[model samples]
Target chain A: MQSFALYPFAPPGDVAALRADLRAWLAEHQPHDDVVKRANCWASFDPDFSRALGAAGYVGMTLPAIYGGGDRHPLERYVVIEELLAAGAPVGAHWIADRQTGPLILRYGSEEQRERYLPGIAKGELYACIGLSEPGAGSDLAAVRTSARETAEGWRINGQKIWTTGAHFSHIMLALVRTEGGSERNAGLSQLLIDLDTPGITIRPIIDMAGNHDFNEVFFDDALVPHGALVGTRGQGWKQVTAELGLERSGPERYLSSHALLIALIDAAGADPEPAIAGLIGKLTAEMWTLRQLSMSTAAKLAAGEDPMVEASVVKELGNAFEQDMPRRVRAIVDCAWDDDADLARLLRALLIASPSFSLRGGTREVIRGIIARGLGLR
Target chain B: MSDARDMLCDTARAVLRGADDIAPVEEVGFALLLVAEGQGGVGGDWGDANAVLHIAGMLAPDIPVADVILSGLGDVSMPHRAAATVSLMAGAMGQALALSIDHVNTRQQFGRPLGKFQAVQQSLAVMACEVAAVDAAAAAMAARLDASGFDADAAVFEIAAAKLRANRAVGVVTSIAHQVHGAIGFTEEYDLRRVTIPLMRWRGEHGNDARWAQALGRQVASFGGRGLWENLTARAG
Candidate 1:
C-alpha cells in the first residue's frame, strides 16, 4: 500500500497576517467565561460572539463575495477555523452554517436557496443543523427513514431526527430524506434544506451526560418547506451528504476541541514540571503537532478539489483517540481530585465525562476505522 | 514531489534494493545529496534527503543510509540525527504496514483470508492510521527542516515533535503488524522483521520518547499554553 503524503497547505496571501488579525480580534471579543466553556468551546452557544466574528469576516470565509462572503480561499478558511477552535472561541452559533451548510448550499443548492440563506449564513445570523441520524440511523446512515414527499405547495417532510445538534436554535436544517417511495438503503435519498420554523417541526432537548443541551431530538410531522428547498439533484442526497461529511470530519475541530484542557494542563504544570508531567505534556504536544500537520494536509487536499475521504477518516480516527486519551492520560499522572475546583481539575473532569462522545460524534470510532480499512483496500 | 526528487528516489531505490551494506549507497554518491552545488555536490534539500532515506529505509533497513547522508554535512546535531531517523522510521513503518496488509489479504483463516475478519481489519486499520500519522509527521518535519535551511537548532521543535511521535508510533505499528501476521511474522525469514526490528531500534536511537518528550515539554511550557499555539502556527505557515 502507498503511504500518505502531506498535501502542501499553501493558502495564498499573508497567512501570518490573517492569523494575527484573527488573534487580535479574538482577544477583543472572545468572552472570558467559565473555563469549562473553553474546553468544548464549539458547543458553547453565544450568538453575539458568533455575530461579531461573522461581522469581522471570519465566518463564511470561503463563500463567494456575492453571497456576503469574504471570497477567501478554503485554506484561508481552514486557518481561520483552526485559530477559532484553538482559542476555544464560542463558535457554536455559526459553526455548522459556516463550515458545511453554507458551502453545501453554494455547491448544490438552487439559486433561490442560495439567495435566501447564504447572506444570513455569511452574516452569522442563520444557523443550520444536519439531519442525518434517526432513531434507527446512527451509524448506518443509509438506514435513514426520514421522508420528504413532493407537493405543489412544497416538500412535506415527516420523520424523527435524533441527536440533531443545534436544531433547537438553528434557523434551518440540511436534512437527508427519502424523496422516492420504496427507496431503501442509500439510493433514492435527497437533501432538503428545511426551515426549522416550518409549521410541523418540533425540536426537544436531549440533555447529554454533562447536562449540556447542545443536541436535540427534532421531529418533523409533515413540515412543509418551499419547493425550492431541495439541494442539488433529487435522489443524490447520499452522495451530497457524504461529501458534506468530508468537510465535517477533518477540520481542526477534531483535535482542537479539547485544547482548553491542554492549555490548562500546561499552565498548571508551570515552567518547571516534574518528569511525569513533563513527559505527558511532551507526548501530548507531539501528538497535537503531528495531528495539525495531518489535518492541514487533508484540508489542503480538499482545497485542491480532491476527495480525501480516507485521509479525512484517518484524521478523525487519530484526532478522536488523542482527544479522548488526553483526559485519561492526564488523570493517570496528575494528583488532581475529580471534585477539585481548580481549572485543571474542572477541565479534566468535564473532558473525562465528555470524552466518550468525541469518538461518537462526527463518526463513531468503529465507523471511522472501517473507513480507514476500506482506504487500506481491506473489505 | 519535484522531478529531481523523484529521480533521486528512483536511483536510491535501485541501488539500495537487496543490498547488504552501505557501500553501493556510498558509491552512488548519496553523501553529496545535501551539499551545496557550489561546493562540488548535488545541493539537494532536506526534502530530497527525506525521500531518499525513506526509500533506503524500506529497501535497506540494516544499512546506515541516514549516517551516510548526514556525513555529507560534516557534523550534525542530535536533533538533525533525530530528524533523519524519523524519515527512516516512517519508511520502515510504512513497509511493515504494507507487508501486514498483504499478509492478511492472502493468509486464510476459517476458509477465508484473515483480512475478511472484522477483528483483523480493525487491527490493521489502527496500524494503518499510526503509519499514516508517522508518514505525515516525517513529511512535515522535512518541510520544516527545509524551510529552516537544515539548521538543526532552528528546526528543533519539529524534530522533537516528529521524532517523538514516530517513536511512540513504533509500538502500535510493530505490535499490530506482528499481531495481524500471526506466527509467521515472528520468524526471521519473514520480511516483517526486516522493518519492525529496525523500527524498535530507531525508537530509542537518536532520542527515546522520554528524552524528546521532556525536552519538548519543557520548551512548550516556556511558551505557555497560548504561546505554544502562537509559536507553532508562526514557525510553520
Candidate 2:
C-alpha cells in the first residue's frame, strides 16, 4: 500500500506576481456574465475571452516560445489556470487545446503538425475536443470501435462519438480509432488528429437535461486525414490517452467548478452567519482546502516528471464527490427554492442539475475508484 | 524526508512498538524533539514532529507521544494539539487502510480473495482516498505550522481545516476498514481497531468537527468570498 505524500508545490519564479497579474487581467477582461455561467466556468465558452487570455500569454504558458508560447514552467501554468478557475473566468473555448492538445502535439506531433496547430492553439483561435467516449464505450473506453483504416489518400475514419464536449465548435479533434482489422480491447488503437470540418464529418448537438448544448454526437463518416495526422506511435493510443486523462482529472477545475456557489454562499451569509450555515461553510472550506493541497501535490508530482496516476485518481474521486455534494448539502441546510432568482438560489439549482455530470464526465466514480484500487495493488 | 527525520521516525517506530505506555516513548528523548539544538535538544521542526507522531500514531496510539513531543514547547495551545492530532489520525487512518488491504487480499470468499471483488475493491478505494485526504491535510498543516514558526494563530486556517478534514474522514475510514475486513476485524486480537479506535477518539480530541468548522467558517467568512481565495494563496505561495 502506497501512502500519500505531499509533493512540494514549489513553482519557479514569482507565483504571487503571476497570480496578481492574472487576477488583474481577469478584472479588466473577464465578462460580468450571469453568475450561473461562472458555476461551471470551464464549460462556458467565450472565444473572445479565451483569445484575449491567449494574447496575454496565459494560454500556452508551458509550450516553447518558438511556438508562440510563454516558455514558462508547468507549475506556472498550474497557477494561472487555478487562478482562472477560482475567479470563475470563462475559459471553455481554448481549454482543451491549451491543457492537453498543445502539450501532446508538442510532445508527439510531427514538426509540420506542431507548426500548423501549436501557434493557433497558443493564440486561442483554434479549439480541440477529445474523441474517447463512444456510444458503447463510456467507462469501458477500451471498447472503442471507431475505426480508422489506412488508405492511399489517408486514414479513413468511420464511427460515432457520443458525449463529445465542444465538438461542434472545436476546429480539430484528437480521436482514438481502431486501426487494425481484428485487434480488440486496448490494442491496435491509434490516435489521429482530424480536422473537424472534413467533408464527411457531421456534429449534432446533444441537448442535455439542463437544455444546454455543451455536448454533441459527432459522426465521422469516412473522414479522411493525411498520414501525418497520426500522433506519437501507432497502436499506442491507449497509453497516450491514459496520459492525457492524468492531465484532465487532477486539475483545479475538478473542485473549482462550483466555486461560484461557494462564493455566493459566503457573501449571502454575512460575517456572523447562523451556526448551521457557518458550520456548512467551514465543512466545505476544509474540504476545498484539503483538496487544493492534494491537487497541488499531484501537479507538483507531474511537474517533477513522475506519473502520479493513483494520486490523480484520488484527487478526481474526492473532488468529484465534493463538488457534486455541495449543492445538495447547501440545499439541505439553507432555505432555497428551485425557482428562486437570488444568486445563491440560482447557482444552487444550476449546480444541482450540473452536479450529476461532474463524476460522469472525465471518468465515472466507479472507474476512478477502480484505478485507485489498481494502484493499491488490488486487481 | 531528510536522513535525520528518517532516523527519528525509525527510532520512534523501534522504541514505541509493542510498548503499552508512554515510558518507552519518553525514554527515546522525544520530549526534546522540538527543542533548539543550542538548548541541548534535537532542534527538529514541525515536519519532524509530524513524521515522528505519524509513526507513533501507527505503533502506539494509546501512548501520549504527542504530549511527550509537545512538552518541549512548555505550553501547547489547542490548535497545536489539533495539529498533532491530525498527524496521528493520518497515520492511524493509513494503518487502517493497510490492514484492510491485507485482510481483503488474504481472506477468501467464494473462489477468490475478497479484494478481487469489484464491490470490495470499490470500498477499499474509498477508504484509501479518505486516508490520502487526511494524510494530505496533516502534511499541509505541518508545512503551515513550520512556515509560521509554530505559531498556531498564524496557521489557524490550516490547523482548523486539517483537523476538520481529518475529523470528517474518521467515519469513512473506520467503517470501510471494518466492512472490508469482515468478522475477524471485530476481534480484539485484530490490528484494525488499534488504529480505528484511536482515530475515533482523536476526532473528538483537541477540537471536534463542529468546533473547528465554526472557527474556520467564521474565519473564512471574515475573509469574505473573494478574500478567502486571496488569503489562502497568499498564505501558501
Candidate 3:
C-alpha cells in the first residue's frame, strides 16, 4: 500500500512512447465485423487475444511481482485499459479480474488466495465478476439480503445477485453477503469469494434493454465454500466493499466511452463547422481536461494508499454524465439521419440503448450528489 | 514556469492589492502596456505587467479609463483582432484575478477558509489557469503587435475566449467567495461587492469567451482545418 508519485502528466517520455505503442496495437486488432456488435470494442470473449495480451505481459500489470504480476505501474495499466477501451478491444474476458478483483485480491487476499488466484488472472486463464448489487437493494448497499452462514465444513451461501456482469463467463464472483445478523444494517456483513462453477451456484444471463447478455441474474442456492473464501473479517465487509467500489468508480473508462462517436461526429459535421459546434467542442474539451485531472488525481491518491471514495464517486458521476450526454449532443448537432445498423452510428444507437444504466449501474446520480455534498460538509 | 513575469506580476499585485490610489492604479496599469520603446504597447506580452491592469480595475471599478480606452478598439484585421483587444483586455483581467483572489481568500465556509473545500479549490485552480492563460496569450499576441499582429476579427475571438473562460471562472469563483463570505460577499459595503459587480461588467464588456471560441472554431474548421494551436505554442514557448 505504498504511495506513488504524480509525475508530469503531459506529452513526452514514456507516456508518449506508451501512447504510440497502444495506438499501433489497437490498429492491428480493430474489430473486423462490418457492424459494431457491442460498442465494447473488446466485446467478444476472445481467449486467444486475452492470452496474447497476457503473454505480452500486459495482464495483472498493477500487481506486485510475488503474485506473478508484471509489477508495472498502475498508471501504465490505466493507459493500457483506456487504450483497449478506446480501440474497442473485446476485453470482456479479462476486464473484471484485471481491473478491481485482481487488485483487490492482491491487496487484501490471503497468501493462499493470492498464489492460487493471481497467476491465472495474470494469464487471463481465469475471469472474475463482482457480485454486489442484488435485485431489491439497489444503491442501498447495506440492505443486501444475500447471506452466508457458517457450517461444519465451511460456509453456505444463499440469495441472489442481479446485474452481475460476466458472471456467466467468469470463474468467480467476489460477493458481498451478510455473514451474520445485527440489530442494525451493516452489522455482520462480509465479502466472500464464491466459485461460479460450484454446485448449486447458478448464473442466468439478464438480457438488458439493449438486448445484450452482458449482465446476469445469479442465484446461490447453498453454494458451499471453505472458510478461507472470506475476503476479510466478517463485519469488515462494509469497509472492504467501500474500497472495492472506489476502484470500480475511478478510471478513464468512466469517461471516454463515446470517444469514437465524438471523432465520428466531428468528421461527419463536415468542413465549415457552425459556431455552436465549435463552442460545444470547446466546452466539452474543457470539461474533459478538468475531469481527467480530477480522475487522475484521485487515482494518484489511491496509488498512495489513500481512500478517495468521495472524490472517485464525484469523478465517476460527473464523467459518466458528460459521456452519456455526448451521444445526444452529437446527434443533435449533426443532423444526418443514421441508420440503426450503420457502423459508428449503430454503435451510437446501441450506446443510447445502454445509456440509462450507465449512471444507475455505477451509482445513481442522487447517491453520488449526496456523497459530494457530504464531502463538502453541506449535508 | 516563467519567472520574470511572475516577479513583475508579484510587484504589480502588491501595488494593486496593497497600495491602491484608485484612479492612478488604473492609469499606471494602462500605462505599462504602452510599449515603453515602440510606438504601441509591448507590456502587453509581459504577463506581470498585465496584472497591473487588474490592479487598476479593482482599485477603481467605476472609472475604468483603461476600459474606455480599449473600448476605442475597432476595425482591426481578423488575426490581429485577438491581440488588439487582448492587449487591451490584459489589464481588465489583471483586475479581475486580483479581485477574485482577494475576495475568495478571506471568504469563509464551515467557519474556516472557503478555499479549503475541494470544489472551491477546483474552481480556484480553473480561475488561476484562466487568468494565467489570458495573461500569457495577451502577452504573446502583444509581442506581435507591430509585426504579424492578428487580424481584426482575431481580437474579437481572442477577447471572447479570454472573457468567456474568465467570466465562467469568476461566476464560479464569485459564488464560492460569497458562499465563503456568507452574507458579507453580497453586501454592498464589503470589499468583494465592487469586485464581484465589476467581474460581470468586464466579462460582458468584451465579447464572451464562449462566443469567441465558437466563432474561431467555425472559422478555423471551416477554413480547411486551420490549426491555430501552433500560433499559441510558438508564443507560449
Candidate 4:
C-alpha cells in the first residue's frame, strides 16, 4: 500500500475550473438569505435545489458519460462537494445518490439496473438511502435480522431498518438483508434494491434533537422485489457493502459538517478578539486544512482504482473528532447562549445538537478506532 | 524512481537504528541530502531530505540535522530553520510515540500492562493522533517546498503552520510519553528521554507555536477571510 505523501499533488486543472464555475453559480443561486437554514448545509433537503444542481451537471461527475454523467475524475466531484459544504449548500436531497448509490449501481448493478437508475441519478430526479443499520444492527451490520427469502416471483424482504436517513423522501433503497440460512453470519447476507413505494414498505420519520426530520425507520414486511433487484452476487453483500462504505468515508462531508460554525466563530470573534480565542481559530483552521488535503489524497487513490480503506477510515475518525470538538472549544472560549435570533448563537446551538451524531454515524468511534488499529496491525 | 532516495533512506536508517549517536550519520554525508549538488553534497528533493530528517529525528542525534542541512544552503534565517524544525520534530515525536506504546505494552503495573487500562489507552490514542497530525503537517510543508523550490515568500504561511503545529505536537507528545512511561521515562537510564528531551529543546528552537501563531494571525488578518481561504485552497500552480 502506498503511504501518505509528504506533499500530495494538486487537483487537476479541470477541478479548479469546475470549482470556479460552481462558485460563480453559487454566488448567484445561493446567498446567505437565511443563516439558520444554510447552517443545515448538506443536511438541508431541497428537491428543487438538487434538481438545479443536476441540471448544472454537478451531481454525477464520476459516473460514465453514457449514463448521463460528466465522466470526470473523482477529484472533480470532490472539488464540487468541498465547495458546496464550505458554503453550506442544501445538498441532502441528492447527496447519497451522487456520493455512492450511483457508483454502486454502475459497478455492481446489471445492465438493466444501471440503465434504469443511472440517468435518473445523474439528473438528481432519483433519491436513495442506505439500508444497512437495523434496530439490532447499528454498527454490527452483519447481525442484520432483515431477512429476504426466495419467493415464487422474486424475493420477499421481511425486516426493518433504523437510522435510514432520507428514506422517507427517497425513491429507492439499496437494502442489505440475509438471503441464506445457517450459522455463518456474513456468508448469508445479500443486498436488494427495493423501490420505496412498494406496498409492504413503511417509512416513519425520526426527529433528531435538533428538531430536524432527517432520520427514518423503514419497515419492510414481505416487500416483494423482482430477481433483477439483487445488486452484485447473492451472499456477497458483506463484501460489496464494506467496499462502498469506503466511498462514504472519503468525502469532504466528514469534516465540513460544522464548517459554517467555524466561519461564524471567526466573524463573531471580531478583528481583535482575545489572543486565546484567536489561537483556537487558527488551530481549528489548520487542522481543517490538513484534513482536507488528506481527504483529497484519499479521493486521488480512489480515482486510480485503489481501495483506501485504512486511509479513508483515518480521515473519518480524525475528522469526526475535530467536528465534534469545534463546538465545545468555541463555547468554552466565548460565553454564548442559544438565542434563536442571534446568527452565531443559532449556528452554535445547531452544531452542539448535531455533534453527538458525528462519531455515531457512518461508523462509531470505537468501531473506527478498531479499524485503524487493525490497519496498523495492532489488533 | 526515488531509487537513490530510497537507498539513502535505507542507509541512514541502518546507520542510525541503534547507534545512540548522530556522529556516524554526519561522517557519512547523510545530512548533506539537502545541501545542493553544487555545494559538495548529495542534492535531493525535499522528499529525500525529509526521509533523512525523519531518521535523524528518531535518533535525536546530538549533531543537529536541521542546522547542518539548512546552514549548508547559505544565509540560514530563523524562518527557514523553523520550517525544517517542524519536519524534524515530527520525526522525533513519531519515535517518542512508538517508544511510549512499546513501554506501556511491555512494562506492567497492577499485575497487568498499562496499555490494558482504558485511561492509558486513551492517552496513547491522543498521542498517536498528534503524531499523525505532525507527520501530515511536515509532509504538507515538504510538498510546498517541492512545488515552489524553497521560495520563502510562497511558503511563509505554510511554514508558520507546520512549525506551530509541530511545536504543539512536541508539547503533547513529550508530556504524554512521560506520563505513560511514568518514573522510568524521567530517568537517564531509560531511552525515553533521548527523544523527549530533543522534543523539549526543539519546542522552543527557531520559534514556538505562540510566535508562529502570531505571524499566522497577522497574515490572516491582513488577507481577510476571502483571501485567507483562497490561500488555503490554492493548488500547486
Give the TM-score, chain B only, in order for the candidates.
Answer: 0.99, 0.98, 0.59, 0.91
Clashing residue pairs for model 1: none
Question: What class would a CAPRI assessor give candidate 3's docking?
Answer: incorrect
Weakest ten-residue segment in model 4 chain A by summed lDDT: A1-10
Error of 2 at A198 (Å): 0.9
> Chain A alone, model 2, TM-score?
0.99
Please list the residue runs of candidate 2 whose C-alpha ends up more than 4 Å from where it truly belongs after superposition. Answer: none
Position B206, candidate 4: lDDT: 84
C-alpha RMSD (angstroms) for model 4? 2.8
DockQ of 1: 0.86
- For A308-347, candidate 1 gives per-residue lDDT tens digits of 8989999999999999999999999999777999999999
lDDT digits (tens) for residues B1-237 of candidate 1:
899988998899899989998789899999999999999999999999999888877879899999999989987888999999999999898899889889988998799999888889889889988988998889889999889889999889999999999999999999999999989999989899999999999999999999999999999999998889999999997
Instruction: Compose the digit string of candidate 4's lDDT tens values, residues A101-160.
Output: 999999999999999999999998899999999988887877888988988899988989
Error of 3 at B46 (Å): 11
Task: Put down candidate 2 lDDT per residue, A226-326, tens digits, no spaces.
Answer: 99989999999999999899898889998888999999999999899999999999999999999999999999999998888899999999999999999
User: How would you encode candidate 2's per-residue C-alpha lDDT over B81-189 as one tens digit per residue?
Assistant: 9999999998888888888888888999898999999999999899899999998888889999999999999999999999999999999999998889888999999
- Every candidate's DockQ is 0.86, 0.86, 0.15, 0.35
Candidate 3's residue-wise lDDT over B1-237, tens digit each? 257556655655555554434465455445444344365553344333334454445464455444433433333233333333343343444444454455555667579765456565554443443343344344433433423343334334333444444445556545544554656657777676665676665555545666655654554344331123222223221
The candidate with the higher DockQ, 1 or 4, is 1
